[model samples]
Structure formats: structure tokens, C-alpha cells
Target chain A: MEIRSMRFKANASAKLADAGLQRNLRKAKGKFVDTRAVAIKEIDDFEGTRRAARDLRDRVLKDLDLWLERFETQATARGATVLWARDGAEICRHVVDIARRHGVKKATKSKSMLSEEAGLNQALAAAGVEPVETDLGEYILQINDNEPPSHIIAPVMHKNVEQVADLFAKTHHKPRKTDIPQLTREAREVLRSHFLTADMGISGGNFLVAETGSVALVTNEGNGRMVTTLPKVHVVITGIEKVIPTLEDLSLLMRLLPRSATGQSISNYFSVLTGVKQPDESDGPEHLYFVLVDNGRADVVGSEYHEMLRCIRCGACMNHCPVYQSIGGHAYGWVYPGPMGSILTPLYAGIENAVDLPNAATLCGQCSAVCPVLIPLPELMRKLREEQVERKLRPLAERLALKAWAWVANRPALYALGTWFAVRYLKWLAGGGDRIRVLAAAPEWTAGRDFPAPQGKTFRELYRQRQP
Target chain B: MRVALFVTCLVDLMRPRIGFAAIELLEAAGCEVVVPEKQTCCGQPAYNSGDRASAAMLAKKTIAEFEPFDYLVAPSGSCADQIRTEYPGLLADDPEWHGRAVALASRVHELTDFLVSVAKIEKIPGAFEGSVTYHDSCAGLRSLGIKDQPRALLARMPGVELKEMTGADECCGFGGTFAVKFGDISTAIAAKKCDNVVATGADAVVAGDLGCLLNIEGKLRRMGDEKTKVLHIAEILAGDA
Candidate 1:
């Protein structure tokens, strides 16, 4: 039932909360930020490009079903089977059926968060197929039997190098050493062998070019290459929202995806595989299939939160978010931790179980500012809060308090009297906003900080003197 | 311009200097400033805490009280943002009140944005010498889009040594109600703010919103490090220049 992991919500004690979920985020934020700056700095018209890209995404999303249908037709025409799935169970069934038909024993995967959303690897494993992760980050988390990913671009962003090394050691049944380079080397060797021997490769598509029916994957390492090209059977599981009407629409995203993600102009490997390689194609998967997973996405369209589908998974939203920057993604208590995750997690899961997700935001609007598609993130999150209220998930106490406030607010006299009490004597009662941190009401505000005493004179009181 | 002051409930009850500073600076700018006495809290607390009924009533009350002015100004970015943004949202269900909400939004301004973009004030006309850093309050920076306005003014001030701190725009953990609801983490983040302030070796810190400043200042004082002082952007601008 826990969509995400529980983290330090509010550590009253400072020391316990200061520990880094992943050392790399702390050690590498400067590098990630700098690389992105350098990339955009090279492109003189990056902002213009971002605007064009945003407009393109807007147009595509405006008629997502149309593009998705076009993509399916185009992809199916190109000799790749495209199956539509309405929910996670359906998506998992499609993937599992593919493996069963192939008699697949080991299914190697690259980084695809949709697969995580569909819980594909576990579904495959439950069906008795060993699903191996080829991406280094995915491989690390997979071997540990741990969570899928913490951040979008960098899956295990919260794990420091030491934890990775230890995970490597435990999974490999070797002695633990907290060395990052050594651990990476170990992962590289272990996953390299799996890449060569895998029966099927299940990769996630960043964008499926509707015109060409080409599945585009942007990866840092070359594993997406191995996962898609090496296996005998290649399957891609992605949300229907990932389709673009044409390559031209994709080109706009190409400029935006890398800079916003990991701060790179382009990822190390950008591979385009069009239908199963031709008869004489040197080396590629022979059986090609794409499972297009809708899974509640259709419900999001034209709704208040339809914009959530515009995410290109840049991780910039998480990088710049104050809450994500501090506690890391895990504390958000969900798979997609930052502002983007807040909206997505609630929608994917029931809003009731994941109620805290909406409250995680400061409503800062920075996530929206940095979003390449310009998704109105904070606004969408607020809309979710509104929905949560309409659904009556909020506690009765809070509901009643708001009603009482509304009643007082409706009566000018009652509100004025309350203001009078606050302006006149609350300072004395609060002892100059002193040691009243723990009070009967507003325990949240008074915790850890004290309020300053209000002056006996309200601004109006002073203004009345001048006029009188 | 005749301006009506919306001194947020927090300032009206806890910190009056912020309200006074806004008045002094507006008066200095040659505007006729008026504080409407019947105005109560802007109802942000109840609203943000998921109490829409109370928030809606307060939003209506706020609109009725300030709709008479040519401009509605506030010293806090968060408050102004709430009035400008949330008020319209609250009154959306009521066609009559929606018009009032829209009217208030059209005239509403956070102090720094209005000061720099409208009143067009430059030169800190006051004397204060020492290194000072700024924390971009969330509402002012993200919601109100006032990032460079205050910083631009601060950089131009005479005798001020401006030192940029890392993550200057990061939230200081004073999310108004959030700070109280999530105190442990609030204090944890506030302690980081204290650390950032100490790192600058700056004599003081300045911000456009008092809510964050108070949280930062309270932690600093409670930690008993008086070397750093907190000031609202208006106080610095209204300096005895």
C-alpha cells in the first residue's frame, strides 16, 4: 500500500535529519547543475528552443489520443506489435504474456520508470522469469531487492556511493567495501555478462516518433543499447502520453531533455530502433513489441491535472525543489518524490492513501518555472488539494475549524473582535511571541519556533490617529 | 496613488515593524497610504490548512474592505500572493464575489515588486555598513516573481557589502503554517539557514517577507548568536539616508 518510502517528515532533532539519503546528490549537485549550464550556454537560442518545445508538447497533449493512435498505426505498420493496456494489471499482463510466448527465462531491462509504475519486473519475476536490470543504477537497486528509483533521471539518487558498494557486496556475496569506483566496476562486470545472455530485453521509450514508428531511448551509459539490440526478443513498455506526432516534435524535446535532466547537452547514448532490424540487420532483437500502457492516463486528460502527463522526466523539478533538495526523494514517501511525483503518485495510487503527497509541496511554483513543458506544477498540486477536500478525505477537526473560520469571516463584527483581541492583548498572552511553542492549538506553527509579540497598535489603529 | 495596507494577520498580531516599514517607505514615495481599520486577517492560514469555507469568507471580507483603494499593498510576499491568487480561486463559485476578488487582484502588489517596478525607487537613502545576504522568500521569488527586484535594490545600496550565499533561494523552512505543522524538519532546515548565514560571515541578512525572517531570526537568537540581525527589505530602503 505504501507507494513510496517513509522519510524524515519533520525531524524535531536536527542531527538525525542531516544524514544524506544518497551521498552522490550532495557531492554531485554542483556537477549536475554545472554540466546543464554549460550545455545550454553552448546553445545561444536555448530559451527560444524551450518555448518552441513547450508549445509543441502543449499541441501534442491537446490531442494525445490522436497522436497515440497515429503512433500505434505507424508502429504496427512497421512490423512492431503495439498492445494497449488500460491499467497496471493489464500492462503487466501484456509484458508477462510476451515473456511467456518467448519462453523467456531472463528478461534484462534498461531504465524505464513506466515499468516501475507497472511493476513489470516483479510481475515477470512472479511469473517465474528472472528480470535483470542492465542500467547501472537499476542494476544496483534490483540486486538489493530494494526500491525501483528515487529520482527520474538518476534512479538511485538518494544512495551514496558507500551504500551502493555495500549493496554490491551483499548481492554479490562478497566482502563489503565503501568504495564507489570499485562498486561500479563490480556492477559493470556483472551486468555486462547478463546483457550478452539475456533472452528478452524490456526497455522504456522516452518518445515514440509517430511518423517513423521509431522508439527513441536517451541513456547515459550504453546499456539501453545492449538491452534493446542484444536480446532475441525486445519489448518496450511506456505510457501512451509518450507519443509525439512526428520526428519534428521529437527534435524540440531532444534539445530540452538532456539539459533539464543531469545538465547535459545530450545523453551519452541516443538510440533509435525502427521495427525489428531488417532481415540482414547486423545485430538486433528479431522480435519487436511495444506495450502501450494507458493505466489511468486517459482519465487525466482535460481534467484539472491533465498537465501532469507533460512531464519529460528531466529531474529538474526534483533538483530545484526545496523539499526534495533537503530530505531527498524518499521522504516524499512515494516513488516520484519531488513536485512532479506529488501529483503523479496521488493520481496513480488513490488520492486518499497518498494524501500527504499533496501537502509535501511549499507551493513554491519553481517546479513549474523550470519545467520544459511549463507544466503548471504548483497549480496542479493545489487543484489536487481541492479535489482531496471535495472527496472529504480531510479530517473532521480541520473541516470544522475551517467552517468556524468561515462563519467568523462572514460576520464582520466577529472577525473585527478577533482582530481586536489579537492586536490588543495577544502579545501579552503570547509573551511577545515567546515560549509558546507548544500550545493547545496550532501545534505545527509553535513547534521549534516562537512568534514575535504583536504591537498593541494595529496599523489601522495608528492610521486612525493621523485622520482623527 | 492611494494605497490601502493589508497588514497580514501574523504581522498585525506578532510583528508590527514590518507594517510600519511598509508605511514609511510608501509615504516617502509620495503615496497617500491608508490602513483600513475594519480589515481582519487575509484568512490565508485557514485557507492553506484546507479550511476553504473560512478562507472563502475571509477572502470576501478582505475584498470588500480593500476594493475601495486604487492599490492594495502588503509587506509579505506570501500574503500578497494569497490575496492576489487564492482570493480569486476562493470566490470562483460566487459570480458576484468573483468580480470583487478579481478587482482586488488587479490592484494587489507585494511591497518589493511594487516598490522596484512601480514606485521606481532606487538608492537605499539610508546608511548601514556591513556584509549582508538575502534569502528569496518562496512567495516573493516563485509566486510573486520578485527575485531580482529586492536583490537589485540591495546591490545598489551604498555601504552594503553584498555576499551571495549558496541556495539563497532555498526555503528557510518557515512555510507559515508548515513550520508549525512540521516543526522538527522546519527547525532542521532553519538550522541550515543559520549555518548559511554564519558561513557568509555577513553581519546581517535581509529578505522581503517577514515570516521567513522571523523564523530565521528566532533560530539565530535562540541559538544565542546575535552577530547576525534580520531586516525586511523596506527597513533597509527606508534607511536614514
Candidate 2:
């Protein structure tokens, strides 16, 4: 909810030191990667599927306004109110206004990153309404002092069972459960009462099917079904980019989403709600509303970053990312985390406020390789870096250093002289050892690893001697 | 064929031996190797840092100097990738430079990739007696499709047992400027990489790029595992390890 992306370095340092969080990160890393590998391998033509998914997304994004309008018309025809929000504040205002108008006392929410982006829970609470997170991970975060979800799909992924055990004991006043099923059962039991009593249900749409005017919700838990059906009113808040042309397109994307996100053939529950409960339908909401939040997405649609809009939020990119693997999601210091977060946070939140997010990655390209929609994540981040330079958003020292290096690099003779001196100076710093443990100029580098010393002569000098 | 060796800035300054080793491998494959003295950097630092002007200037300079050679080869995958993949995109708006960049991109290759794919050398230049695990540098693996090239070359060596480490393709976090700016995070990632490398119980960990090798080796030494060797693919393939 808060933009602390400016403190990325400090937050990353703390996360790197947080032993419990590190353990959790390490434990969770293998499952996502290994399972996705297995799931993808099972597909006869996974690359073709990825291409189709990319095309599907790009097609919708190319005519995004047309798709959104079609979705609005279809949804309205099916007796659902479609509201557009320009940004987070408006999204929250729309939801809160709906709640106040309905005299809603409490609302149960499934896992919706857009809601997190809108700070929907805090807004509802401020408006004198209670918001309960029904998804297991989201519920855990809710009970734990309303801590922000560190991960997109797995909200409480930063916490280990031990931490959750302590939190559950402290908050639930129940006996601590060390085993996972018991803990999950405890959470389900706790949320069951709120699910039934809640007058309004809030959800995030995985994909809005324009063909059927459907809001598709994908989740591992049954909460998605309960949240949408067991309430008087249902409000779906999602990004405008979530729209697809047709249900057939949804089918094509569904083949990749769950497999990429959590490596499941299909999630436990996939609900497609067309409209409010008809007279014949006994178990559905009375009121249905769609709140499509543009929130900087419209600006991205036709830009160089339009490829980013194709993301289905499967989070395979982040799951495969090495930086995300090292520092968990919270270190990103935003509602979104990992490679996608690095791009989205800078674009949605001002780049000036979140400069480090773009520069934090090693440009490892693992994210790009794993993305189901095949977003060139590393390239996009590089473009963001270019934008930073264009806007003069980077620090003066870094810009100047690059400028100086470029100047020397352009002149071969000067560059040779500079490098010769650099090698000798570094060799002197190494004190004849094979490594330099303390580099005064780059303390950051020597902080954790020794610098391998130069091999005494530059390659050019060696090459020249070999020639003569 | 006369091949100009783009020795790479890191190989030029940090370890000239990799350059020599690359030259040896290329010559063994029946190619005349030339080191273009005018070359300094591939401008990855500036390009990645978003200084396109500097990156473009260096790219153009590199393109002009290396253009005359029959082929351009580099010891490092990242730099080769910068020239082969990124240069055209970086200079795309300029008609003259973009064409040059495109022409040069096809001619550039990483050392092992050239050795196996282009040179098609059948005999190995060097032999090793112990086990070695390969680290796939990110750019080489993803950008240039360089996974099998180095391994295939190493397979030709005598007594070289390739012990595959878990997540061999995973990043070691040297990411150039990223290692310095986000040192702690880079170290943390490299620490896990070291763990994987050590778990294989190989005598050496080798990679196609010096940047990743340096990071892996630096972290390995800092972790007090001095016996395990960290070598470039050129060194191991050239029997200099």
C-alpha cells in the first residue's frame, strides 16, 4: 500500500539478513521452479501455447478500448454494473461507495492483487466496514497485523510455518499447530464464519471473458466460489488489462496460467460468474459490479512497455527470478514484487519514487524465459533504465561515472593507458596476492567477496608480444 | 578464416590468460586469430545503465574496428551477446550504424559456440583429469542459445568428467554493475550458487563468461572453499586450468 520502493537497498539488506525469511524463500523456491519445469515438459508444444497466449494478450491489448467496451456491454447486458476507475483512489472510492449504498457491514475478499493495489481493506475499514481476506494466504496476512502480501499468488510466502504458528497462536488464542494441514484447517475454520456473515464479496478477475460477460476467478482454495456466491453483493476489482476477446481465448490462457503460477494442471476452483443470481439460481449474489481500474495501464498500452500488459499475472517470471529468489518479495517494498514488480512499480508508481526497482535486477533474463506470455522482462527493465537516464532520474555520480568511462572507451589509446594503470593499481592493491579482499574504491564489492586480481598485463600487451 | 578476438574488457584487464586461451582454441581450429588493439569495451555497462549515447559510440567504434575481419569472436558470452544481439537494437534508429550492427551481429560468436558451430573442430585442444561443473552465464544461455556449445566442446576433451550441478543455468549474480550496487543481494544469490557448485563435488566450476566466473569464484573463496577451481570455459577447454 505504501510506496517504500525508494528504500529498496536497505529493505533488501534487511531481507538478506532475515534468517527466517531467507529459509522460507529457499524452501519455497524449488517447488515453483521444479514443478513448472515438469508441468511445461508434459505439454507437447509448450512454446506454441506460449506464442498463442502472447498473441491472445497482444490482440486484446491492441484493441484494448474495444475489448473493454465489449466487456462492459456484455456484462451490463447480463445485469452487472461495470464501473471504470482511473486510478487506485477511484477504485477504492467506487468500492466504498457501493458498500455504503448497500449498507454493507462486512465484505469477504478472495486473493485480488488489484485490491491490494487499491488498499481496499484499509479503505473499507476507514469507511466503517470490515474486510476479511478469505484466501488462506491472504487470511494469514490479515491476521498478522494486516501485513502486506509479500508475494502475488502466495501472499504469506515470506513466512515459515513456525512464524505462522506463532502468529496463529497469538491471534487465534488457539493451540499452536505445527503441521500445515492443521494450520490450513484452522484458517479455513476461522474464515468460514466471516464468509457466511459477510454481506459483500470482493474479488479480482483472472480474466474477463467478453464473449460470456464472465468474471473468471482462479484459486487453489474454495474461497473464490464462497466469496462470489455466499454474499448479497459481489464486486470484482481488477486491472483493465485483464480483459480477453472471448471465452476461447480464456481457455487458451487457462492452459498456461495455473501451470505457470503454481504448476497445477488446473487450480482447485475455477469460477466463471456471468451475472447476478437469476431467479432460478439459488446460490449467487443479488448485485454484481465490475470495477475496471486503468491506473497507468492505459499509458502503457501503446508504449514500448505494451508487452508488459500481456502479463497474465501467473508470476512464473518472479518465481524464476534469482533476485526474487534471494530477497523474497517484501524487499521489493511495494504491492507487487519480483521482475514484474520491478517494471510495474516504476511505471504505476513514479519512476523517481522507485528508481532502484529497475536497477535492482542482474538482468539475468530468467524472468523473461519463464514468463507464460513471453514478456521480455529484462529488456523492459533495460528500457526503464533508459527512461531513467533520459529523465535524469539516476544519481549524478552514476551518470558521470558512465560518461567518463564512455569517453575513455571511445578513445582506444587513452583507454589502453587508463586500463594499464588500473591493472597496476589493482595489482598493487592486491599486494601480490591472487585476490583483493578490501577494495577501497568499491567497498560494496569487497563487502562479501574478494576481487580476483588482474593477471598483471592487459590482453593487448600480451597479444602484441606474441605477435613480435 | 581470420577471426578478430574481442577479448572483452574483463578478459583484457582482469585475466589476459582467457584471451590467450581463446586465441589458442581458435588457432587450433584452423583459424588465424587477431586481437584488435583499438577495442576497449562492448559498452554493456553504459548500455545497461541506460546511457545509450555512450553505448552507441562504443558500439560504432567496435563495429568499425572489427568489421574488416572475416569473423569476430569473444571469450565472454555477455559481451558477444551485447554485440550480436543488443547492438542492432541499440543502433536501430540510425540507418548506417544499424546496418553495420546487423552485419556485425551475424559475424560475432562466443568462443565455444564458434569452435563447435562455426569452426566445427573435431579434436579437443586440452584434456582434464578431474570432474568439472559448468555454470551457464545468463546471456550466453538465454540470449545466444549457448548451453550445449561449451559442453559439447568439453565432451571432446579426454578424462574430463562433466558433473552437472543443480540449477547450472541459474545466475551467479555478477550482473556487472548489479554486483556492486546490490552487493548484498548479489552475494546472497552467489552464495546459493556456490552451494550448488559445491554440492556437485567437482574440482572446478566453469562458465562461458568471466563476469559470472569471477562472481562464483569470489564468493566461493570468500566462503573459504579455496580448493574448488573457478575457471572460464576457454581455460578449461584450452587445458590451462
Candidate 3:
């Protein structure tokens, strides 16, 4: 939630040098791309499903206020409390108040990106109520003094098995265990008691079904079930954009979400809760709270970046991004990372502070291609870069160079003369070698590569000579 | 078809042979090709840098320069994609050039795409004997959907064996100004790309975009691995290598 995206380049440079992290990234690189490809290949009409999902999301976003009001009405009618928060601070205030009212000394939590975005755990801790992360990955992060989640789906993806084992060993004061099943069992054993004794449970909403007045949660781990079912009071915190018009729309997104996420046709658990448990009902929470948080999403609705609201947080963009693959997620230096982070950070955090986020991309378009909702990430990044240029946020040298180049490019004769002179200058710089190790303007271009020496003559000159 | 060649700035100044090869290939395919002298840069550096004004200025100049031809083709996919896909949007706000920009966009084509889709050449006019792997420039491969077009043309060459490299579609880190701006990250990405190209043991690496070729080739040369030569798709198709 903190605006650290200004440090993205420096963070990436540091990340690139960490061999352990690089090895982790390399090992996990192609798994997402390959699995998603296989899952997509099995579906006969995957594109049709994507289109359906996109259309439904677009429709919901078009009249988001109406949908949110409808959802609130339906949810309230179903014997659930619906509360709206204008921003992260407001959400934290409401959460802390609710926790204190419930006499909640500790709260169990499922993996929730909304909670991360709001810095809710820190807020809860400040309010004197401990928040126990129930999801294994999140639990590891929480136990490690709340280090950031690197990837959305795989929070501790930056850590290897050995690192996790070391973390668990240090936390539990037990002998180090390296085997995954044993480690998982250890985590389960440690978390089982917290799940039973926690006074409250908090989870993130995957989708808010407007028609049925239910909140949908899809997770691979059993912890979401435990977090929702064990505590007397249950709270779901999510963005305002998660509302869907119908269960049918929810079904369309379901087919795409898990497949695009971890290549599962469906996650292990899909919980659709309409309301709190009735007097006669068993094995459910006594109260439910739906907190809708609007940080900056309302401003994005009609803006040029409205399409970004369609994201379902499947993270297919991050998984397929070559830049993300190279440097890993921490380099993004935010709650979100990878391609989606590049767009969202600038918008959510001030663009002035996060200008480097958009410029970091190579305009590869891999993120958009794999995006189930088909957000044109590269084009949006370009737009953000243009905003920077218009704001004069770029280096003075670069801006002046671009302006000078554009001036010459607009005139044919000037461009011709410029190219001829530039080619000759480059040839002289090369010193008759086929490769030039350095250039006067850009020493960085020659840092790790040899620039090809320009040919002695420009093509315009050659063409003129050939003309009969 | 009478085509006007928009020899991109990099090709014109750094690699004129690519421009010559493009003209040779077009003529051999039974199309009358004219090299337009007024054409300069495609303005991608400006466009990608978020300087839309310059991008628009260059786009309008390019549109007017090649307006008379039935087709406007370029050897670089990044440049061609700029003219074909981005020009209309770049000039959208301009009352004078908006219509012309959009009209010119329809006539614009990357050289390989033009040869395969428009000219309908049965085969490349000459033979290239070597095992060459192809690197797909991000702009060309994703923007123009040009994966099969170059491969389809390359398949027609009698003696050329296409040894595919792993991660060929990955970016070569030469995102124009990005190479200088994010130099370390760019070089790191290019290092990996060149590693993949070398792993294939191909005698040469061919690509449709010269920007990517130059980046990959520069990295290879820097690493002292000059066994694998880099050539544009035009040079291979023209058999001028």
C-alpha cells in the first residue's frame, strides 16, 4: 500500500543480482505459461468464456454505483450488514471498531489482497487484535513480521522450500524440516489452534453476486473455509469493482479465473455465502459484514484507465510477463507486482511517485495476451508514459533529445541530411571496426553489448546513386 | 502492385543492405518496388517514450511521403507496426492528417507480411544454405501477428533449415530508448535472449525486425560469440547474406 514504486528500477537491479532469488524465478518461470496453455487447450470455447466474462465485467463497471447499491440492498435484505468505506483509512477504522466491539483479541484471515492493500493487519495490530493469516503462504508471511506478498496467488514465491523451512524452524523453535508435506503439516498443526480460538475471521471477496446477495470466494487451500466457518463474526473486505450482476456471470468468470490462475479447472473450495447462519442452521458464523472499499476505483470508472477495473486478480499477466520473470515480484516494490502492478500502482498510488512503473515494461504485450479479461496493458503503459512526458517528469536530456529528433523527423530534407551526418559520425566512432563498444550519447547502450557500426552510406544516398 | 519502401531509420543508416535486400525481394516477387527518399524514422522512439506530438509529426510525414503508392512496406516489423497500427491513433486528434493517417494505415505492411499475404510469392527467390533460428521481435510478433509469415516464406527457401530456439518470441531488450534508459535490465534480458539463441547451435539468427537483431547481435558480439551471425529476414529472403 505504501508508494515504493519510485524505487522499482533500483529494486529490480538489486533483485537481478540475488542469485538465490534469480534461481527461484528461473525454476518457477515457465510453469504458469505452460499450465495455462494446457488448461486453455482443453476448453473448446475458452475465448467464448473470456468474452462472456469481459462483457459481464464491462456491464457491471459501466454502472458500478447502481450495481454496488443493488448488491448492498440484496445483501442487507439477506440478513447481512453491508458497509462502505471511501478509502483505506476508512476501511481500517471500520475494521478496528468492529474487532473491538466483538471483543476480538485475535482474528483468523484467508489470503486477501484487499486486506494487504489496506494494510489491515498493521491496523489490527495497532488496535491490539492479532491477525493470524490462515492461508499457508500468508501465514508464513505473517509469521515473518508481515513481509509483503511477492505474487498475488503465490505470496511467498520469492522463497524456496529451504527458506520456508528455515522460517518455520525459526518461528516454531523446532528442528528444520525440508519436505513439503511435513512442512504443510507443521503449518496446519500450528494454525489449527488459532483457527479454533480466534474470536473473528476476515476474508476477501472474490465476487459480490448482486442478484443472490452472496459473496463468492474461490481458493485452493482449506484455510478460506476454516476462516469463514470457525469464528463467530465473519468480515469480507473487497474492492467495489468485484460486484457481478448475476450468479450466471459469476459462473462465467469462475471458468476463467482458476484456469488462468493456477490452471485448475476449479479451485479446491468455492464458497458462496448469502447471509449469516439462521438459528436452526449449524456450522456457520453468527454475523457477516461486507465492507466495500473504494480507494481510487471510482475515479477510474469513466477515465481512460476504466478497463483496468475489469481485472479479476487472476495474475495471468504477472505469470506470463517476461520482465516479471526476469526480476521476480519484489522488484515491483508494492502490494501488487508485475504487469498489473505497473498499471495499478501508478493509478492507485500517485502517478508522479510511480512513473517508473509503466516505463519499465518493454511493451511486450505478453500480459495482455494471457489476460483473461483482455486488458491492453502495453497500450495503457504507453498512455502512462505519455502522461509523464506531458508532465515533464522524464529526464531533461531525454525529453530535449526526443523533441529535437521529432523536429528533424517532421522535415524530410532535414532528416535526410541528419541521417547522412549521423551515419558518418557513427562510422568514425566505430574506428573501422564492425562493432562499436561505446557511444558518446549513451554509454549504457554499450554497457553489455556492442553496437553495430553504422554503414558508411545512408540508404537514401544509395538509392539516389542507383536511380537511372 | 507498385509498393513504396519505407526503409526505417535504423535500416537506412545502420544497415542499408536490408533496404537493398527488401527492394530486391520485392522486385523478384513480380512487384514494382520504389524506394521513397523522403521517408526517415517511424517515430517509435518518440511514440514509445510518450512524446505523441513528434510521433504524430513523423507519422503524418511518412503517410504523405508514401501516399502515392498502392502499398507501403518496411523491412522492420516494429516500424511497419507503427505505420500500420499506431499511425491512425497517433494522428486521431489532428483534423488535417487523421483521415490520411487511417487510410495510409490500411496500405502499410511489414515486408514479410506483404510478400506472403499481398504479393503471394510462391517461394523466396533464392536459396540460403544454413541452419538459422528466428527471433520474434515483440512488436512484430504480437502487434502484426507475424510469426508464421516469415516462417512460411523461410520454408520456401530450398536449402534453409529452420532450427527453432527456445523462447524465440521473448524480447531481445532493445526497446529503442529502453536500452539506454534501463541499461542494466535491458542488458540482462538481452543476455538471456542471446543465450537461448546460442543454445540452438544455429549458424545464424534471423528476425523480421532489425532493432531486435542489432540488440541480440550486439550482445552476442560483446560476449565474443561471433559464430552465430545475425541477419534480417529481408537479407535471408533476398539471398543476399
Return the top candidate by TM-score. 2
For B61-124, candidate 1 gives per-residue lDDT tens digits of 7888899999999988898999998788788999999988997797899987887877776544
Q: After superposition, how far is residue B76 of candidate 2 from its true place, in Å?
A: 0.9
Give stretches of model 2 more than 4 Å off. Answer: none
Q: Which model scores highest in DockQ?
A: 2
DockQ of 2: 0.91
Better of 1 and 3 by lDDT: 3
Q: What ordering of candidates by TM-score runs from best to worst?
A: 2, 3, 1
Worst 10 residues of 1 chain B by lDDT: B119-128
Which candidate do you rate higher for DockQ, 1 or 3?
A: 3
Predict model 1's lDDT versus the native: 0.77
List model 3 lDDT by residue over B104-222, tens digit each. Answer: 88898998998989998765766789899999988888889999999999988878899999998888888888788887888888999999999999999999888888888889999
TM-score of 3: 0.98
Query: Docking quality tier of candidate 3?
Result: medium
TM-score of chain B of each: 0.95, 0.99, 0.97
Enumerate residue pairs that collide in model 3: none
Query: What is the DockQ for all candidates, taken in turn?
Result: 0.50, 0.91, 0.80
Better of 1 and 2 by DockQ: 2
